[model samples]
Structure formats: C-alpha cells, structure tokens
Target: MRRTGPTTVTPVKDTGPPGRGLLYGLGRACARHPWRVIGVWLLVLLAAVAADRAWGGSYADDFDLSGTPSRTGSDLLNAHGAAGSRGVAAQIVVRSDAGPLSAHRDTLTAAGQRLTALPDVISVAAPLDTAGAVTDDGRTGYYTVRFRENPAQFEKSYVGRVDAAVRALRADDVTVEYGGPLGQLARPAAADRASEAIGIGTAVLVLLLGFGSVAAAGFPLLTAVIGLLAGLSVLGLLASRYAFAAASPTLATMMGLGVGLDYSLFLVTRHRKLLHSAEGPVEATARTVATSGRAVLVAALTVTAALAGLFASGVDFIGMLGVAAGTTVLVGALAALTLTPALLGLAGRRIDRWHVRTPVDEPDDSGDIWHRWAATVRRRPWTFLLLGLLGLGVLGAPAAALRLGHVDAGASPVSYTERRAYDLVADGFGPGADGPLTVVVTLDKDHRTTGAQRDALARALRDALTATPGVAAATPPKATEDGALLVSTVTPDTGPQARATTALVHRLEDDVLPGVLSEEGATGYLTGTTAAQQDFRDILADRLPVVVGVVVAAAFVLLLAVFRSPLVALKAAVLNLLSITASFGVVVAVFQWGWGSRLFGIDETVPVESYVPMMMFAIVFGLSMDYEIFLLSRVRETWLETRDNHRSVAVGLAGTARVITCAALIMTSVFLAFLLSTSVVIKMLALGLGVSVVLDATVVRLLLVPAAMYLLDEANWWIPRWLDRLLPRLDPEGSRGRAESTGAAVPAGRVTR
Candidate 1:
C-alpha cells in the first residue's frame, strides 16, 4: 500500500516472510541446550568473583617523577611525592564554640596530640606552637599535617584510621572540616560504592521498563553483571602486572555494563519484533542473531579500534585504559553474540511475553514521525544543516578556554575517607602541598664536572629558581655525577600561592633553564605534575586529529557499504561531530570550570585533567556511533526496498525508536554508574558521557535527524547519477527471498509480520 501526498494514514501491518527458518533453528538449539550457554557464563562469573576477592585494590604510581618521563612530569607531583613537598598534604581547620583558644585549649591539645601520633604522620603543627595556627580572626585554628609516606603511597588502612578519628572528634563537639588530596581521594571511594549501587539499580529499573517482562528485563542485566565480574577479574590480573590506578574498576564497570546491556537490547528487540509478526520464536531469534549480531560485532570492533588508539598516546594510564576498555567491550560483545541468543532460544516464546498493547492496523508505512522528519529534511536540507552547525559551534565555545590542572580527589563528593583526609590536609597543611615539581639537571657526557663546577651548578640552580617569580624558594641542588646529574627541590606558595609557584617552575624550565642548558651543552628536564600536564596537552592536540580522522573514515566506510547511500553515510558522520561537540562542551563546563563547585565539592581552582579530551574523544566517538548504527540500520533496511527516502526514514525510525530509547537509557545508567567511583576524573568522565549519550539518542538521533531528513525529500536520496553508476550496489534489495520495502512502508509478512 503506497500513497503519494500527505493524507489520513492507516497503520500498516507486517507479515514476516518465510525466510525465518534460520531463526527457528537458533531458537531450537537454545531450547534444547539452554544450560550450554548458562553453564559457561555462570562459570565465568564465578571465577571473576573469586579472583576479585583474592586480589586487592589497585594503586600504581604511573606518574612518579623518579620513573620515566611519562608520569614524571610537573603535573604529576602528587604521584611522585609532591604533597610532602609533593605528596598528600592535609590542613585541618578545627574550630571551637567554647569561646577562644584559651577556653578549648585542652580539647584542641588532645585532638592535636591524637593526630600527631597517627601512623605515617610526618609532623603536625598546631596554633599552640605559634600564631601560625590561629586564623587572623582568632576564632578558627588550623593544624598542618604532613605524611611521612608519599600521598601517592598512602595506604587504604591508614586512611581508615583518619576517617575514624574525624568521626570520633564529633563527640568532642568539634566539627572536623578538612580538605586535601588525601581527603579528596578518600571521599570518592565511598561515593564510588554508593554510585555503583545506584547505577546497578537504575539499569535494572530501565531494563524492566523497556522490556515490559520480568524475565526479559532481567536477562540483559544478568548478562551485564556477568560481564562486569569477568572484566574485573581480568582487571585484577592486569593489576598484578602493572601499576593500574584505583579508578580502573570504575571504568571497567561502566564500559562493561553500558555496552553489554546495549548490545543485548538491540538483539532482543529485533528478536521480539520478529516473533510478534508470526515468525516462530526460534526462527525470529536466529534472524536477529545473524543480522543484529553482525551489527554488534562490527560495532564492537569499531569501539575496540578507537580505544586501541590510546596506545599511541605514549601515556601509561591512557594505554592501560585503552587495553582495559577494549577488553571489556570485546568480552561484552562475545557475550551478546553467543550467550544472548542462546538465552533467547532457551526462553523461546517467553521472550516476547512482555508485549505492550499493539495498535490495530498500525501503518505498514503510514504517518511515522521519522518519515515526516525525513520528508521535511529532504525538502529543506540547508536549514537543518545550518541549525546543526550552529548548535555545535555554541557547545564548542567553552572548550577554547579549558584549563588543565590537578584536582583534589576529595573534591569529587565528600562521602569517602580520602576526601575527608584530603580536606583536613588542605585546611591544616596548605594547598599546592599535595603535588610538587622536580627539576632534573643532566650534564653533557663530555663534561666531567670538578667540585667547583658542582658547587657552581648548585648555586646557579638555586639562584635561578629563587629569581623565578612563582617559585617560593629553591633548595640547593644535590650533585650526583661522575658529576653528570643533579636534583633540586623548589617549594611553591601555599594554595593559591602554589599557582604562581607552578607557573614559576615552568618559567624556570621553559624560559630560564633552556638557555642555561644550551650554553653549557647540558640538558635539564624539569619533571613535575605541572610539566607533565603541559606535555600531555601537547601530545593530545597533536594526536586528536589523527584519532578523529581514523574514526570518521572507518565509520564512513562501514555506513557507505551497508547503506549503499553516500548521502546517508555523510549525514551520520556529521551528526556524530554534533553529538561529540555538545558532549565535550558539557564536560568542559562541569569539570573544567567547576561551575557546580560546591555540589561536587571540588575546588574551583582545580585544573582539568590533561588527558580528558583524548579519552573523551575515543569514548564519545565509539559510544555515540553505537547509537548511530542502531538507528541508521533500520532506516537503511527500509530505504533499500522502496527507494523513497522519506518513507524509508519514517519506517526505520518507527521500528527502531523503542529499542533505541531503551538502549540509550541503559547505557546512560551504566555510564553514570562511574559516579560511584572514588576518583574525580572517573566521575567527571562518566557524568559527561552519560549526559551526552542521553541527549544524542533523544534530541539528535530521534528528533533532529528525522526532522531534517523529512525536509530533504528526494534530495536526501540523491547521489550523483554518475557516481551511483560507478559504485557497486551494496544493499541487497534486488535479491530474491529478502523482504520488499518502500522507503515509507514495509509490506505485510516481513520479519515482523
């Protein structure tokens, strides 16, 4: 049934084709050997649980300055020990309602003594020592506590003690408000726990809502949990070999659950649609496996490939993230292709038992919103195009002023011990006390410096550091050569003072040391958290273009080959850019600008992580494209048969909307689950990504895409008639046994007859 102009439309009914025999066979296998799939996955889950329990938490000093330059930069001060000059620096601001210092003297002394005796306590200085501890107002007092162990090396066990102490102090009517890296890190560990719980719960709720059947809703979540367990087990093994950071589990959980559930959603949605149309459940399940399964494999490969590019970053953490995320996605894909279909077969008709009330005489190709959208886009392509461009430009505006810096982990959400401890450090000790800078001076191999030369070099290094505007002071350089090497320490101003100090460190390295080294034929490597950040930014800027190009190129080829429509493929690529830009804009606003500073409990002054952009690009590109493929695949199926661009877009959108919405919801929930992790970077990444995916599926994919396509009309399908002739046909519409579809209408008795 087809109509030319807009008119009252009758809902089209689908009558699935006879080619469902393959699907039936898959269902039969699952029905006959349900345990086959269950047994294997169960074993995997069990093993993962076992391994996680056996292994401990992860904490690796990938950014330590004494190591290779990758982590040994100024930006990675705390990683190397800057809080102790560069380790975990905590300043506790203890206030009393008992009048003044004289009235609460005993309580303050007792609290101070208790803190000073804590393990790994370097030194605790209180107001009793001098006026340094008392605020200018004289009502508030600060206690400075430096850790003997590098904050990077602070043990979880030690953090627990500090947390207990903070709690116990409340009994004394003393409010313990603290700030620092130690407290920050501790805070998120707890939030991470809570966030994980919320994420898992959200996933379950969404799955049930979308699937509308208890069994169906629970199936994907079950699969995801299994995948998470297995992925974490593998993560544990990796932890054994590398200095994997604590944030890895959060990342693993997110990628595993989000991708795992989304893949299952796609497969199950197709399977159910087929069954509802009279294809035997078995047959429908098989077809879904073959078609959607193929799509899943391709999608997984694309994600893995994008993640793999992180290896080129030459940064260990980024490299580890690439490997870990890639592994989890692969594992999740495997589970989808194998375990999911097997589960469907086992469940048989029960899979579609959760059906919503279907409207009678639903248009086989009539009045679908997607169709209207396509018609509109085809008619007025330029308006939609311009509008899309403008939106992207607006979102990308904030990215221009993004400033990278080391954010205290406690600033994330103050529910963890680390954050409490960190706050204490900041309140008492000082800011910029958590991360420090290292200056490495290496002499020319030809120069064997005598004693006088060593003294001169030390003196020159100290004087140069002192003269630098930002540096608080420069300690004498320790000579270590056959006199070929020397190391010096420079302390920056406290807190805000540290900003100028960090700048001064850079000035010494960039403006001062280069000239000195060049003249002496020696090389100076200024390694600190600040320096490392600069390097990371440089590396990311250089490689981002390559990463974006590779992803776009790969996606274009895949879409082009699949749809046989260059216009369609190009549209997908452009839309992806829009999705990413909007998402990145949101990330920059929340994480970089600290706009909601008090809400997340992070300092507005905290710098954005240097690698956030690169990581976000790889992740957002892959995840966003997943939605792209899911939506476009249906549209392609419709367009191939009818060759009516508007009709095809409508039919495709109608068929896919429910499934895409469900999948997006699940994926967003899983990503937001990272908010449970104890790392600021992890939370920020998760929050940014989660918000973006939701927007992409709903706003970009659903509304704008269809509206624009609707306006385009026949032009949407236009290819240079000449180029169309040269390109080999990719769609299989002409082949027998395949369903015949018009761009607007799929005939009765197709897959979902």
Candidate 2:
C-alpha cells in the first residue's frame, strides 16, 4: 500500500488481463467494415417494415379482465345476447339547441332507419321509442347503434360510412355528436410525425451545442432514428399475433426516439473524446465502445429488465407495452454498439468536419465546474442531501394521494367529438349519463327464477340500485330469453373519473348488490366500461407492489453484479426510486389534482390512468439507472486508480457530468415534445418521463448522489468478501484506464496524460 496524503491510501493494483474485451472486438470489426454494417442495418429495417406491412396482425386493446366480476358479467351478457343483438353499442348523441328535441323526432326517426339499414347493424334504438333515451327537457336524445362487433375493431373509414348513416340529422339546428369508439374515429387526427420532428429537432440543438459540430450531432440522430424505425417495425410484427394497446406504437416512438438518442449520444461523446488523441479511428472506436458503450449496454439491460418486470402486474396489455418500449431500447443499444462505431470510422479524424465551432470534449480538471460542484456537496453533505430530500419530498407528496382509473372523455380536448358528446350528455341528463353502470344478476339454476318470482327479484334489485346513496337513476331490469339473467343500467351522480364515482362503484359492489341479492339465490355485479375500468384500476393497485418489488430487486442484483458493491447497488435502487417518486407526484398534481391540467389540453381532472404509474415506474426506474451507471462507472474507474474515495468521487463526477447533462437535456426535450399530443394519456406519459429525467439529472445526481457517496466514503465500496467473490468483475471504465496505462491495447499516441 502507498499513501499520497495523511488520509489517502492506495491499494495494490490488480492487472489480471492485458487484452481488449468483446465490446472492443465488436466495435473494431464494425468500424473496419463501416459500409457493411450500415448496409446490414438498412436491410434489416427494410425487411422488418416490409414483412410487418404484409403479415403483421392489427393491434387491438387487450382489456382481458379474466377473473373480475365485470368480466364475468360481460361474458354472460355476450353469451346470452344481452349486449344488444351482437356486441357493445356505438352511440350517436343528438341535441337540439333551438328547442325541445320533439321537433327533431322526424329527423331522428329517419336516421335510425338508415342506421338500421347499414351492414353489421343488429339494432338501432329510436330515441322516441326507448324509455329514458330522451332527456327530461326533451332537448337531447341519443340513438344506440348496436353492431355485430366493436366498431373500434374496424377501420376508421367504416366509421365514416356509419357517420354518413346519420347525415340527415346533421342540420343547422341539431348538434350531433358521436360517442364511444365512433367518437374516437370522428376526432381530428393528430400527426405523430409532428411530435417526432419536434423531439428530433430539439435533441439536435442540444447535441450541436455540446459537440460543437453538426456532423457529430447528426450521427447520433441518424443512429437513433434508424433504431427507432426498426424497433417500431418489430413492434408492428408483434402486434400481428398479440394484442397491444393502440397506444403501444406511440409509446414506442416516444421511448425509442428518446433512448435511442440517449444511447447514441453517450457513445458519440466518448468516441469523439478518444478520437481526439488516439492514433487511429479503429483504436479509438474500440476503446470508446468498451468503456462508454458498456454503460449503454448496461443501461439498455436495466431498462429492458425493468420493462419485462411489468408482467408482475399480471396484465398482458401492460406487459406488452413494456416489450414494445424495450425492443426499441435494445435496438438502440445495438446501433450504439455497432452502427455508431461504424459511422465514427467513416468520419475518421473528420468527425467534426461540418463544424459550427471547434469540437470540445471533457475539459482538464483544474477549472472543472463539476469538480467544484462535487466538492461543494462533499464539504456540506448534510446540507445538499437534506436540500435534495426536501425538494423531492415536496414534489412527490401528491403521489401519496394518487388515485388510478381511466380518464373519461370529459377530460379530452373539446375539439374531440367524444368530449362534446360527454359534455352535452352531462348538461342534458346529468354527468352520470355518460358513464352508466350496468347491473347484472345471474339467477341460480337451483331456484325457479321465472314468472312473478324472476320479475320480483329484478324489481327488488332495480329498487335497491335506485335507492343507493350515489345512484341518480336505475332502469327496470329486463330478462334474457332463458330468464336466467337480469340486467339494468344504474346512473350515478358523479362523472366516471371522479373519486365519488369510484366510491359509488365500491359501495354498489360491497353493499347494495349483497344486501339486495345475498339470500335471493343470485349473483350480482356491476358491468360496463365505467365499472370495468374501475375493476382494472383495483387490479393494478393490488399488483403495483409486485411490479415495484420485482423491478427493484432485479435492478439491485444487476447493479451488484456490475459494480461488485452491495451498498452502491442498494443506493442506486433507492435513489432511482426517489426520482420516480418526484415524477409520480408531478403526474398526480397535473392529472389528478387538477394543477396545470389545461396545459396538457385536459379539460377536467382525471385519475392517473390505471397503468400510467406502472408504466412510468418501469420506464423511469430503467432510465434513471442510465445516469447511475454513467456516473458510477467513471467514479469506480477513478477509485480503482487512486484508491481515494473523495478524489475518485470528484474526478468521476467531473469527467461524466457534462455528457450526462447533455444526454438528459436531449432526452427530457424529446419526451416533453410529446405533450403536444391532445391525447391525455400520451401527455401524462410525456410529462412524467420528462420531469423524471430533469429531477434525476439535476437534484438527485448533482446534489443527493454525490453528497451521500461523500458521506459514506469507503463504505460505499464495501461488500461481503463472499458476495464480492460471487459477483462478476465488470469494470467498463476501469479496464480502459488500465489498457491506456499499460499500453497493452493502444498505441503510445492513444494514451493521453
């Protein structure tokens, strides 16, 4: 051992290996055959897109609630022909602003007849004929068009035909709106390309400013776009056989673009730095890939693993979404590991050929702002740590009150027909009219549930529902042909997304249903989109702990394996969770607490979409690890070299801070651009992701992480001897330093002071 100062001690060096690793070999090979690597990627992209176009299965939302009461009730309804004649209805809402809708009876009748004449139409209820279909004021009426299947399953053009079916009622005096999937089809389409362009545009600016070279900045964008397209193509192919949420591609695009930029940006930054002093492009590319590229690989793995853990939610729709995003992340890593080096090789020493300013890499440490920042944290560890905790605690406080459910159409942009329809229905018949819950009772086979007995049971159930504290109205129950089931709709006083609505659902399930039918030899359940959404919310809430535990444990293990330090791994997990908590609070504040909801085009407060937290946790957890690995890898390298905890922390933070900050800026910009989307769900995901990256990069990374590591000192690197021996020695940045110091894998020209 050697001592550099009174308190600084140096440990014996372990120089077990003197050869380049597989990452270097891959990078060297790709760099040596740049054209071939680029060509192969293009071919893969083309084949994936072509095959997906020809053979890919369409994406349909998988709301497969197998064991829930709502699912059972829904299944019974479908089996017994109670869900209209064939399937769920696509509604048409008609309101006469001029006067009572009685004046529009002739128009409504003609529209119903035309709708009834359309193919796949099982039945069309004329507002005048169906009881309670017209509002009390008679100013608003709706036509329920029951089809053989969900209209959402068909092409939007089909809805256009359905729209034509009601053209006669679209007069100046009549305010007509579509509901359900029909309304979704009727809304003006938002261009996903516009959002993508904005993200790419903003990312380019950050890269340009950081790299000071247009060509260098363009490389990351090129690699990222290629990876994103390839990933989306694969997602399309997966969608052919599996049911993915319709938003899967949108989510994929958002993540793929952001993380694709992330992986490529870091690789390019390291490559440029190495190429500046290295003898040849091949040597620089090899070293860059082995060092920073390893960080990218670990990051992608953490992200993919965290995403895979979404399966713990026990929902395929949610899990498949993870798959969709993970595929892009993995592909982006591939591009960084191979395509990035290839592009670097093609550029050679002229990587900054199209320079706006002389390219700048990491600065010498004497005046490094990051070093000053790290020292500041080290000197006042408690102050910085407490400051970080306070900021995160305040930001994350609202998440404690997080409520999960589906965002109703009432929260959508008014430009959407669904929103208009929701508003009109609420204004005419009360808020509950848009989210009516169907009450279903399955009569026991042992009992004679027929004639007066069945009628009496039905009446009792209906009466029970109508008299419930939250219910505004309840329709008379109608029996199926076999008389073994009875069904009715219950209208609650609150909107579907309201907390009161959630409470009402629970009250119905826990009290009214059992009280009315517990001894009547019947099983009752609330069924409908509203009830089903709430059921799904409960399922997610129950399984959230499973997902969080699995993802955290897996991440902890991965960090342990990579760093060979239990405390470091544990700290990473805890810190990542802190960042996620802050992000969750931001989401709850905006979407649930109604704080700045208008900025996202949301007209009303909506529950955090049931799966948003789950998805955000997986994504943020994975992504936060990227910065963790980037900073820690460099710190570990320094610790290995000098064996001084304080110096290593300062040098490591200084070395990597600029790159990490640039990457975070680009990623945050890419994600935030998606807030331009009118879809509330997309906006929620955007804000959560964008906010998480900012907090993680700034408050957590700059303040909390260094401060804690400084306070812990040598303990930060401690692990049980047995545990250390069991863990793999994976030193991504350390080996590069060793290789440079020994001149084993690089020329003398490649080694910089």
TM-score of each: 0.76, 0.93
Runs with alpha carbons beyond 4 Å of true place in candidate 1: 1-28, 55-193, 204-211, 352-365, 368-382, 409-432, 444-449, 494-502, 603-605, 676-678, 707-753
Query: How many residue pairs clash in model 2?
Result: 1
Model 2 lDDT at residue 129: 85
Local accuracy of candidate 1 as per-residue lDDT tens digits, 1-753: 433332222333233442334433554465457688789788877877687667644654344323445254333334333333443446666655555555566767777788878887776777667534564445566676777555544655766676565554566676566544454334433345566677678877776665566656667777766776787787777776676655566676678778988888778777766666645766666667656765677778777777877766656767677677776888888787777877887778876455453312223465665456555666666776677667767876777776655554445445654455445445544554434466777666555446676677668777877787666556677755246566776655554223464466557767878766677676677664445555555566676677678767876766665555576778777877777777777777876666764465455545566666677777877887777777667665555455556667777777777677778887887777666554667767887788778877876776567766666554555455455446544332111124433123322111221
- Cα RMSDs of all predictions? 7.7, 4.3
Tens digits of per-residue lDDT for model 2, 480-555: 8877788898999988888889999999999999998989878888888899898899999999999999999999
How does each model score on lDDT? 0.63, 0.84
Candidate 1, position 83, lDDT: 30
